[model samples]
Target chain A: MKKVKVYVTLRESVLDPQGSAIMGALHSMDYNEVTDVRIGKYLELQIEEGTRDVDTVVREMCQKLLTNTVIEDYRYEVEEAVSK
Target chain B: MKKVKVYVTLRESVLDPQGSAIMGALHSMDYNEVTDVRIGKYLELQIEEGTRDVDTVVREMCQKLLTNTVIEDYRYEVEEAVSK
Candidate 1:
Protein backbone atom coordinates (compact mmCIF):
# COMPACT_ATOMS: atom_id res chain seq x y z
CA MET A 1 0.00 0.00 0.00
CA LYS A 2 0.98 3.60 -0.52
CA LYS A 3 0.06 6.92 1.03
CA VAL A 4 -0.03 10.25 -0.77
CA LYS A 5 -0.31 13.75 0.64
CA VAL A 6 -1.47 16.63 -1.54
CA TYR A 7 -1.44 20.33 -0.78
CA VAL A 8 -3.22 22.99 -2.83
CA THR A 9 -2.92 26.73 -2.35
CA LEU A 10 -4.26 29.75 -4.19
CA ARG A 11 -1.86 31.67 -6.41
CA GLU A 12 -0.42 34.79 -4.81
CA SER A 13 -2.08 37.06 -7.34
CA VAL A 14 -5.57 35.72 -6.77
CA LEU A 15 -7.93 37.50 -4.43
CA ASP A 16 -8.93 35.42 -1.43
CA PRO A 17 -12.03 37.01 -0.01
CA GLN A 18 -12.41 34.38 2.69
CA GLY A 19 -8.86 34.93 3.82
CA SER A 20 -9.43 38.69 3.90
CA ALA A 21 -12.57 38.33 5.96
CA ILE A 22 -10.81 36.14 8.46
CA MET A 23 -8.07 38.75 8.76
CA GLY A 24 -10.64 41.43 9.46
CA ALA A 25 -12.34 39.34 12.10
CA LEU A 26 -9.04 38.58 13.73
CA HIS A 27 -8.21 42.25 13.90
CA SER A 28 -11.58 43.10 15.44
CA MET A 29 -11.11 40.38 18.06
CA ASP A 30 -7.92 42.09 19.30
CA TYR A 31 -5.65 39.79 17.40
CA ASN A 32 -4.30 42.85 15.61
CA GLU A 33 -0.92 41.26 14.97
CA VAL A 34 -2.34 39.02 12.29
CA THR A 35 -1.41 40.61 9.00
CA ASP A 36 -2.60 37.93 6.64
CA VAL A 37 -4.47 34.66 6.23
CA ARG A 38 -4.13 32.20 3.40
CA ILE A 39 -6.51 29.32 2.92
CA GLY A 40 -5.51 26.05 1.23
CA LYS A 41 -6.52 22.42 0.82
CA TYR A 42 -4.89 19.16 1.87
CA LEU A 43 -5.66 15.61 0.79
CA GLU A 44 -4.53 12.21 2.01
CA LEU A 45 -4.83 9.26 -0.33
CA GLN A 46 -4.36 5.57 0.33
CA ILE A 47 -3.36 3.57 -2.73
CA GLU A 48 -3.49 -0.17 -3.34
CA GLU A 49 -0.11 -0.72 -4.96
CA GLY A 50 3.34 0.51 -4.05
CA THR A 51 5.36 1.74 -7.02
CA ARG A 52 8.23 4.17 -7.65
CA ASP A 53 6.20 5.95 -10.35
CA VAL A 54 3.44 6.89 -7.90
CA ASP A 55 4.80 10.38 -7.32
CA THR A 56 4.74 11.27 -11.00
CA VAL A 57 1.20 9.99 -11.41
CA VAL A 58 0.02 11.88 -8.35
CA ARG A 59 1.58 15.10 -9.58
CA GLU A 60 -0.02 14.72 -12.97
CA MET A 61 -3.37 14.15 -11.34
CA CYS A 62 -2.98 17.29 -9.29
CA GLN A 63 -2.21 19.30 -12.41
CA LYS A 64 -4.94 17.78 -14.56
CA LEU A 65 -7.91 17.59 -12.20
CA LEU A 66 -7.19 18.26 -8.55
CA THR A 67 -6.41 21.98 -8.91
CA ASN A 68 -6.85 24.93 -11.23
CA THR A 69 -3.30 25.55 -12.27
CA VAL A 70 -3.98 29.12 -13.36
CA ILE A 71 -5.16 30.10 -9.89
CA GLU A 72 -3.76 27.40 -7.63
CA ASP A 73 -0.50 25.57 -6.96
CA TYR A 74 -0.30 21.97 -5.78
CA ARG A 75 2.33 19.58 -4.51
CA TYR A 76 2.19 15.96 -3.43
CA GLU A 77 4.29 13.26 -1.80
CA VAL A 78 4.07 9.46 -1.94
CA GLU A 79 5.22 6.94 0.62
CA GLU A 80 5.18 3.15 0.71
CA ALA A 81 3.23 1.66 3.58
CA VAL A 82 4.75 -0.94 5.92
CA SER A 83 2.66 -4.05 6.37
CA LYS A 84 1.55 -4.85 9.91
CA MET B 1 -0.98 38.02 18.45
CA LYS B 2 -3.22 35.02 18.07
CA LYS B 3 -3.19 32.08 15.68
CA VAL B 4 -6.24 30.26 14.40
CA LYS B 5 -6.14 26.89 12.70
CA VAL B 6 -9.08 25.77 10.60
CA TYR B 7 -9.70 22.29 9.18
CA VAL B 8 -12.42 21.59 6.64
CA THR B 9 -13.41 18.17 5.38
CA LEU B 10 -16.02 16.93 2.94
CA ARG B 11 -19.12 15.38 4.41
CA GLU B 12 -19.03 11.59 4.50
CA SER B 13 -21.89 11.42 2.03
CA VAL B 14 -20.23 13.64 -0.56
CA LEU B 15 -18.41 11.90 -3.39
CA ASP B 16 -14.82 13.02 -3.53
CA PRO B 17 -13.85 12.41 -7.14
CA GLN B 18 -10.26 13.56 -6.79
CA GLY B 19 -9.78 11.29 -3.81
CA SER B 20 -11.29 8.39 -5.73
CA ALA B 21 -9.00 8.88 -8.71
CA ILE B 22 -5.99 8.99 -6.44
CA MET B 23 -7.11 5.77 -4.81
CA GLY B 24 -7.38 4.13 -8.22
CA ALA B 25 -3.90 5.27 -9.17
CA LEU B 26 -2.53 3.87 -5.94
CA HIS B 27 -4.12 0.52 -6.68
CA SER B 28 -2.57 0.46 -10.16
CA MET B 29 0.82 1.27 -8.63
CA ASP B 30 0.62 -1.91 -6.51
CA TYR B 31 -0.60 -0.36 -3.29
CA ASN B 32 -3.76 -2.46 -3.26
CA GLU B 33 -4.39 -2.44 0.48
CA VAL B 34 -5.56 1.18 0.46
CA THR B 35 -9.29 1.70 0.59
CA ASP B 36 -10.15 5.39 1.08
CA VAL B 37 -9.04 8.97 0.58
CA ARG B 38 -10.57 12.08 2.07
CA ILE B 39 -9.63 15.58 0.93
CA GLY B 40 -9.92 18.74 3.03
CA LYS B 41 -8.86 22.33 3.54
CA TYR B 42 -6.74 24.05 6.16
CA LEU B 43 -6.30 27.71 6.95
CA GLU B 44 -3.92 29.46 9.30
CA LEU B 45 -4.62 32.99 10.43
CA GLN B 46 -2.20 35.28 12.23
CA ILE B 47 -3.99 37.85 14.35
CA GLU B 48 -2.56 41.06 15.75
CA GLU B 49 -3.95 41.27 19.27
CA GLY B 50 -4.42 38.34 21.60
CA THR B 51 -7.86 38.10 23.17
CA ARG B 52 -10.08 35.50 24.80
CA ASP B 53 -12.87 36.02 22.28
CA VAL B 54 -10.70 34.97 19.35
CA ASP B 55 -11.87 31.39 19.36
CA THR B 56 -15.54 32.26 19.06
CA VAL B 57 -14.89 34.74 16.28
CA VAL B 58 -12.75 32.29 14.38
CA ARG B 59 -15.40 29.61 14.57
CA GLU B 60 -18.04 32.00 13.29
CA MET B 61 -15.79 32.94 10.41
CA CYS B 62 -15.36 29.31 9.47
CA GLN B 63 -19.09 28.71 9.50
CA LYS B 64 -19.86 31.85 7.54
CA LEU B 65 -17.12 31.86 4.87
CA LEU B 66 -14.36 29.34 5.35
CA THR B 67 -16.42 26.26 4.58
CA ASN B 68 -19.71 25.02 3.16
CA THR B 69 -21.38 23.63 6.25
CA VAL B 70 -24.00 21.68 4.30
CA ILE B 71 -21.40 19.65 2.48
CA GLU B 72 -18.38 20.10 4.68
CA ASP B 73 -17.38 20.08 8.36
CA TYR B 74 -14.91 22.51 9.87
CA ARG B 75 -13.15 23.02 13.23
CA TYR B 76 -10.81 25.68 14.48
CA GLU B 77 -8.39 26.35 17.35
CA VAL B 78 -6.89 29.55 18.65
CA GLU B 79 -3.58 30.06 20.41
CA GLU B 80 -1.74 33.12 21.69
CA ALA B 81 1.55 33.53 19.92
CA VAL B 82 4.74 34.19 21.83
CA SER B 83 6.64 37.29 20.80
CA LYS B 84 10.02 36.66 19.35
Candidate 2:
Protein backbone atom coordinates (compact mmCIF):
# COMPACT_ATOMS: atom_id res chain seq x y z
CA MET A 1 0.00 0.00 0.00
CA LYS A 2 0.96 3.61 -0.46
CA LYS A 3 0.51 6.25 2.17
CA VAL A 4 -0.41 9.80 1.18
CA LYS A 5 -0.25 12.80 3.46
CA VAL A 6 -2.39 15.76 2.42
CA TYR A 7 -2.32 19.29 3.78
CA VAL A 8 -5.11 21.69 2.87
CA THR A 9 -5.05 25.37 3.69
CA LEU A 10 -7.08 28.41 2.82
CA ARG A 11 -5.60 30.53 0.09
CA GLU A 12 -3.51 33.40 1.34
CA SER A 13 -5.95 35.95 -0.02
CA VAL A 14 -8.82 34.41 1.87
CA LEU A 15 -9.88 35.23 5.40
CA ASP A 16 -9.98 32.47 8.03
CA PRO A 17 -12.55 33.24 10.72
CA GLN A 18 -11.92 30.07 12.68
CA GLY A 19 -8.23 30.82 12.87
CA SER A 20 -8.88 34.37 13.94
CA ALA A 21 -11.28 33.22 16.66
CA ILE A 22 -8.69 30.81 18.02
CA MET A 23 -6.04 33.49 17.96
CA GLY A 24 -8.29 35.83 19.89
CA ALA A 25 -9.04 33.11 22.41
CA LEU A 26 -5.35 32.48 22.90
CA HIS A 27 -4.70 36.15 23.45
CA SER A 28 -7.47 36.36 26.01
CA MET A 29 -5.99 33.32 27.72
CA ASP A 30 -2.66 35.17 28.13
CA TYR A 31 -0.76 33.63 25.25
CA ASN A 32 0.10 37.14 24.11
CA GLU A 33 3.12 35.78 22.31
CA VAL A 34 0.98 34.35 19.56
CA THR A 35 1.07 36.66 16.54
CA ASP A 36 -1.20 34.78 14.19
CA VAL A 37 -2.90 31.49 13.58
CA ARG A 38 -4.04 29.62 10.48
CA ILE A 39 -6.03 26.45 10.78
CA GLY A 40 -6.14 23.79 8.07
CA LYS A 41 -6.92 20.16 7.39
CA TYR A 42 -4.61 17.19 7.35
CA LEU A 43 -5.53 13.91 5.78
CA GLU A 44 -3.84 10.56 5.43
CA LEU A 45 -4.84 7.98 2.87
CA GLN A 46 -3.77 4.40 2.32
CA ILE A 47 -4.03 3.31 -1.28
CA GLU A 48 -4.44 -0.26 -2.32
CA GLU A 49 -1.80 -1.86 -4.50
CA GLY A 50 -2.18 -1.34 -8.26
CA THR A 51 -4.04 1.93 -7.75
CA ARG A 52 -3.42 3.85 -10.95
CA ASP A 53 -0.35 6.11 -10.85
CA VAL A 54 -0.60 7.26 -7.25
CA ASP A 55 0.41 10.83 -7.90
CA THR A 56 -2.18 11.48 -10.57
CA VAL A 57 -4.88 9.71 -8.64
CA VAL A 58 -4.28 11.61 -5.44
CA ARG A 59 -4.05 14.97 -7.17
CA GLU A 60 -7.30 14.28 -8.95
CA MET A 61 -8.95 13.29 -5.70
CA CYS A 62 -7.83 16.49 -4.04
CA GLN A 63 -9.13 18.56 -6.88
CA LYS A 64 -12.41 16.75 -7.14
CA LEU A 65 -13.42 16.44 -3.52
CA LEU A 66 -10.69 16.89 -0.95
CA THR A 67 -10.51 20.64 -1.39
CA ASN A 68 -12.38 23.67 -2.61
CA THR A 69 -9.83 24.76 -5.17
CA VAL A 70 -11.34 28.24 -5.51
CA ILE A 71 -10.49 29.10 -1.91
CA GLU A 72 -8.00 26.50 -0.76
CA ASP A 73 -4.68 25.00 -1.76
CA TYR A 74 -3.65 21.43 -1.13
CA ARG A 75 -0.36 19.59 -1.30
CA TYR A 76 0.49 15.99 -0.61
CA GLU A 77 3.39 13.63 0.05
CA VAL A 78 3.34 9.97 -0.86
CA GLU A 79 5.25 7.15 0.77
CA GLU A 80 5.26 3.36 0.56
CA ALA A 81 3.28 1.90 3.43
CA VAL A 82 5.13 -0.53 5.68
CA SER A 83 3.83 -4.05 6.04
CA LYS A 84 1.40 -4.73 8.90
CA MET B 1 9.03 35.54 14.50
CA LYS B 2 8.81 31.78 14.58
CA LYS B 3 6.46 29.61 12.57
CA VAL B 4 5.09 26.48 14.17
CA LYS B 5 3.31 23.66 12.38
CA VAL B 6 1.12 21.48 14.54
CA TYR B 7 -0.42 18.19 13.41
CA VAL B 8 -3.10 16.42 15.45
CA THR B 9 -4.21 12.92 14.64
CA LEU B 10 -6.50 10.33 16.18
CA ARG B 11 -4.54 7.76 18.13
CA GLU B 12 -4.13 4.39 16.45
CA SER B 13 -6.38 2.71 19.02
CA VAL B 14 -9.12 5.30 18.52
CA LEU B 15 -11.82 5.12 15.86
CA ASP B 16 -12.31 8.06 13.48
CA PRO B 17 -15.88 8.56 12.34
CA GLN B 18 -15.08 11.47 10.06
CA GLY B 19 -12.37 9.54 8.29
CA SER B 20 -14.66 6.60 7.80
CA ALA B 21 -17.35 8.79 6.30
CA ILE B 22 -14.93 10.30 3.83
CA MET B 23 -13.62 6.89 2.90
CA GLY B 24 -17.15 5.66 2.28
CA ALA B 25 -17.83 8.68 0.10
CA LEU B 26 -14.70 8.01 -1.95
CA HIS B 27 -15.68 4.38 -2.43
CA SER B 28 -19.15 5.39 -3.60
CA MET B 29 -17.49 7.70 -6.08
CA ASP B 30 -15.59 4.70 -7.47
CA TYR B 31 -12.23 5.41 -5.87
CA ASN B 32 -12.17 1.80 -4.82
CA GLU B 33 -8.38 1.93 -4.71
CA VAL B 34 -8.54 3.83 -1.46
CA THR B 35 -7.97 1.44 1.43
CA ASP B 36 -8.13 3.76 4.41
CA VAL B 37 -8.56 7.40 5.32
CA ARG B 38 -7.64 9.39 8.41
CA ILE B 39 -8.49 13.02 8.94
CA GLY B 40 -6.87 15.45 11.34
CA LYS B 41 -6.17 19.08 12.01
CA TYR B 42 -3.25 21.25 10.96
CA LEU B 43 -2.39 24.49 12.63
CA GLU B 44 0.18 27.16 11.86
CA LEU B 45 1.19 29.62 14.53
CA GLN B 46 3.24 32.73 14.18
CA ILE B 47 4.98 33.38 17.48
CA GLU B 48 6.21 36.79 18.48
CA GLU B 49 9.82 37.32 19.34
CA GLY B 50 10.79 37.17 23.04
CA THR B 51 8.23 34.51 23.74
CA ARG B 52 9.38 32.51 26.72
CA ASP B 53 11.10 29.36 25.47
CA VAL B 54 9.05 28.70 22.30
CA ASP B 55 9.29 24.96 22.68
CA THR B 56 7.79 25.06 26.14
CA VAL B 57 5.06 27.49 25.15
CA VAL B 58 4.03 25.54 22.07
CA ARG B 59 3.98 22.26 23.92
CA GLU B 60 1.78 23.78 26.57
CA MET B 61 -0.54 25.19 23.94
CA CYS B 62 -0.78 21.86 22.18
CA GLN B 63 -1.48 19.97 25.35
CA LYS B 64 -3.89 22.52 26.74
CA LEU B 65 -5.93 23.55 23.72
CA LEU B 66 -4.63 22.53 20.32
CA THR B 67 -5.22 18.85 20.86
CA ASN B 68 -7.33 16.45 22.86
CA THR B 69 -4.75 14.06 24.29
CA VAL B 70 -7.36 11.57 25.37
CA ILE B 71 -7.90 10.24 21.87
CA GLU B 72 -5.47 12.24 19.77
CA ASP B 73 -1.71 12.65 19.42
CA TYR B 74 0.04 15.79 18.28
CA ARG B 75 3.49 16.71 17.03
CA TYR B 76 4.99 19.98 15.88
CA GLU B 77 7.78 21.58 13.88
CA VAL B 78 9.10 25.07 14.44
CA GLU B 79 10.93 27.26 11.96
CA GLU B 80 12.04 30.87 11.74
CA ALA B 81 9.31 32.92 10.04
CA VAL B 82 10.28 35.15 7.17
CA SER B 83 9.39 38.81 7.65
CA LYS B 84 7.04 40.45 5.18
Candidate 3:
Protein backbone atom coordinates (compact mmCIF):
# COMPACT_ATOMS: atom_id res chain seq x y z
CA MET A 1 0.00 0.00 0.00
CA LYS A 2 0.97 3.59 -0.45
CA LYS A 3 0.04 6.88 1.19
CA VAL A 4 -0.31 10.19 -0.58
CA LYS A 5 -0.48 13.53 1.18
CA VAL A 6 -1.86 16.60 -0.52
CA TYR A 7 -1.72 20.18 0.68
CA VAL A 8 -3.80 22.92 -0.91
CA THR A 9 -3.61 26.61 -0.22
CA LEU A 10 -4.88 29.84 -1.72
CA ARG A 11 -2.55 31.72 -4.02
CA GLU A 12 -0.55 34.45 -2.33
CA SER A 13 -2.20 37.20 -4.37
CA VAL A 14 -5.72 36.21 -3.45
CA LEU A 15 -7.27 37.81 -0.41
CA ASP A 16 -8.35 35.30 2.23
CA PRO A 17 -11.30 36.80 4.07
CA GLN A 18 -11.49 33.99 6.61
CA GLY A 19 -7.83 34.33 7.49
CA SER A 20 -8.23 38.10 7.71
CA ALA A 21 -11.18 37.76 10.04
CA ILE A 22 -9.26 35.44 12.32
CA MET A 23 -6.37 37.88 12.42
CA GLY A 24 -8.73 40.67 13.32
CA ALA A 25 -10.36 38.61 16.05
CA LEU A 26 -7.00 37.69 17.49
CA HIS A 27 -6.02 41.33 17.62
CA SER A 28 -9.20 42.25 19.46
CA MET A 29 -8.66 39.44 21.95
CA ASP A 30 -5.27 40.87 23.01
CA TYR A 31 -3.14 38.70 20.74
CA ASN A 32 -2.24 42.01 19.20
CA GLU A 33 1.05 40.83 17.73
CA VAL A 34 -0.22 38.66 14.92
CA THR A 35 1.30 39.50 11.59
CA ASP A 36 0.01 37.16 8.83
CA VAL A 37 -2.57 34.42 8.65
CA ARG A 38 -2.89 31.83 5.89
CA ILE A 39 -5.35 29.01 5.63
CA GLY A 40 -4.82 25.80 3.67
CA LYS A 41 -6.02 22.21 3.28
CA TYR A 42 -4.34 18.90 4.09
CA LEU A 43 -5.36 15.52 2.71
CA GLU A 44 -4.18 11.99 3.49
CA LEU A 45 -5.04 9.24 1.04
CA GLN A 46 -4.41 5.50 1.16
CA ILE A 47 -3.85 3.78 -2.12
CA GLU A 48 -4.60 0.10 -2.75
CA GLU A 49 -1.96 -1.19 -5.12
CA GLY A 50 1.76 -0.66 -5.20
CA THR A 51 2.44 0.60 -8.70
CA ARG A 52 5.44 2.09 -10.41
CA ASP A 53 5.54 5.75 -11.41
CA VAL A 54 3.13 6.69 -8.61
CA ASP A 55 4.49 10.21 -8.26
CA THR A 56 3.69 11.17 -11.87
CA VAL A 57 0.18 9.79 -11.58
CA VAL A 58 -0.49 11.62 -8.31
CA ARG A 59 0.86 14.88 -9.68
CA GLU A 60 -1.38 14.55 -12.72
CA MET A 61 -4.36 13.95 -10.48
CA CYS A 62 -3.60 17.08 -8.51
CA GLN A 63 -3.31 19.17 -11.66
CA LYS A 64 -6.23 17.77 -13.61
CA LEU A 65 -8.93 17.42 -10.99
CA LEU A 66 -7.91 17.63 -7.35
CA THR A 67 -7.04 21.33 -7.23
CA ASN A 68 -7.85 24.62 -8.88
CA THR A 69 -4.59 25.81 -10.38
CA VAL A 70 -5.85 29.34 -10.92
CA ILE A 71 -6.52 30.32 -7.34
CA GLU A 72 -4.99 27.48 -5.35
CA ASP A 73 -1.63 25.75 -5.08
CA TYR A 74 -1.22 22.04 -4.36
CA ARG A 75 1.65 19.72 -3.51
CA TYR A 76 1.62 15.97 -2.88
CA GLU A 77 3.98 13.34 -1.51
CA VAL A 78 3.79 9.59 -1.89
CA GLU A 79 5.18 7.03 0.54
CA GLU A 80 5.15 3.27 0.49
CA ALA A 81 3.51 1.56 3.43
CA VAL A 82 3.78 -1.94 4.83
CA SER A 83 1.04 -4.32 3.77
CA LYS A 84 -1.04 -5.86 6.53
CA MET B 1 2.12 37.12 20.54
CA LYS B 2 -0.21 34.21 20.26
CA LYS B 3 -0.58 31.43 17.71
CA VAL B 4 -3.81 29.76 16.72
CA LYS B 5 -3.96 26.54 14.75
CA VAL B 6 -7.19 25.45 13.15
CA TYR B 7 -7.84 22.06 11.61
CA VAL B 8 -10.90 21.63 9.41
CA THR B 9 -12.11 18.33 8.11
CA LEU B 10 -15.14 16.95 6.33
CA ARG B 11 -17.73 15.37 8.55
CA GLU B 12 -17.53 11.58 8.57
CA SER B 13 -20.99 11.40 6.99
CA VAL B 14 -20.05 13.46 3.95
CA LEU B 15 -18.25 11.86 1.02
CA ASP B 16 -14.79 13.15 0.28
CA PRO B 17 -14.39 12.86 -3.48
CA GLN B 18 -10.81 14.04 -3.59
CA GLY B 19 -9.80 11.61 -0.89
CA SER B 20 -11.55 8.81 -2.73
CA ALA B 21 -9.72 9.57 -5.93
CA ILE B 22 -6.39 9.52 -4.16
CA MET B 23 -7.22 6.15 -2.66
CA GLY B 24 -8.01 4.86 -6.08
CA ALA B 25 -4.74 6.15 -7.38
CA LEU B 26 -2.89 4.39 -4.60
CA HIS B 27 -4.59 1.15 -5.48
CA SER B 28 -3.53 1.46 -9.07
CA MET B 29 0.00 2.16 -7.95
CA ASP B 30 0.31 -1.37 -6.50
CA TYR B 31 -0.49 -0.41 -2.94
CA ASN B 32 -3.24 -2.98 -2.68
CA GLU B 33 -3.47 -3.15 1.10
CA VAL B 34 -4.76 0.31 1.87
CA THR B 35 -8.09 1.04 3.47
CA ASP B 36 -9.72 4.32 4.64
CA VAL B 37 -8.59 7.84 3.74
CA ARG B 38 -9.59 11.19 5.15
CA ILE B 39 -8.82 14.76 4.07
CA GLY B 40 -8.78 17.97 6.07
CA LYS B 41 -7.50 21.54 6.31
CA TYR B 42 -4.90 23.26 8.49
CA LEU B 43 -4.49 26.93 9.25
CA GLU B 44 -1.84 28.87 11.17
CA LEU B 45 -2.52 32.37 12.41
CA GLN B 46 -0.25 34.74 14.31
CA ILE B 47 -1.68 37.26 16.75
CA GLU B 48 0.10 40.40 17.86
CA GLU B 49 -0.49 40.74 21.59
CA GLY B 50 -0.62 38.24 24.39
CA THR B 51 -3.95 38.58 26.13
CA ARG B 52 -5.86 36.67 28.73
CA ASP B 53 -8.69 34.32 27.74
CA VAL B 54 -7.10 33.48 24.39
CA ASP B 55 -8.58 30.01 24.21
CA THR B 56 -12.17 31.25 24.41
CA VAL B 57 -11.58 33.89 21.77
CA VAL B 58 -9.89 31.49 19.37
CA ARG B 59 -12.62 28.93 19.79
CA GLU B 60 -15.25 31.52 19.01
CA MET B 61 -13.34 32.58 15.93
CA CYS B 62 -13.31 29.03 14.60
CA GLN B 63 -17.01 28.56 15.29
CA LYS B 64 -18.08 31.87 13.82
CA LEU B 65 -15.85 32.34 10.78
CA LEU B 66 -12.80 30.11 10.34
CA THR B 67 -14.89 27.11 9.35
CA ASN B 68 -18.23 26.13 7.92
CA THR B 69 -20.09 24.23 10.61
CA VAL B 70 -22.57 22.58 8.25
CA ILE B 71 -20.38 20.14 6.34
CA GLU B 72 -17.05 20.58 8.06
CA ASP B 73 -15.61 20.15 11.57
CA TYR B 74 -12.97 22.41 13.10
CA ARG B 75 -10.63 22.35 16.13
CA TYR B 76 -8.12 24.91 17.31
CA GLU B 77 -5.31 25.45 19.80
CA VAL B 78 -3.64 28.60 21.13
CA GLU B 79 -0.06 29.06 22.35
CA GLU B 80 1.94 31.95 23.71
CA ALA B 81 5.29 32.88 22.16
CA VAL B 82 8.15 35.14 23.07
CA SER B 83 7.71 38.67 21.70
CA LYS B 84 10.39 39.68 19.22
DockQ of each: 0.44, 0.89, 0.43
Candidate 3: tens digits of C-alpha lDDT, residues B1-84: 776777788997999987787668756864455475688988877755545466765676677767789999987777775556
Decreasing lDDT order of the candidates: 2, 1, 3
Q: Compose the digit string of candidate 2's lDDT tens values, residues A1-84.
A: 999999999998999999999899889888999989999999999998683898988998999889999999999999999878
**DockQ-better candidate, 1 vs 2:** 2
Report the lDDT tens digits of candidate 1 across residue range B46-77: 76654446766677667766779999988777
Which stretches of model 3 miss by more than 4 angstroms? A50-52, A82-84, B1-36, B47-84
How well does candidate 1 match the true structure in TM-score terms? Answer: 0.59
iRMS values for every prediction: 3.6, 0.7, 3.7
Better of 2 and 3 by TM-score: 2
TM-score of chain B of 2: 0.96
What is the lDDT for A21 in model 3? 79
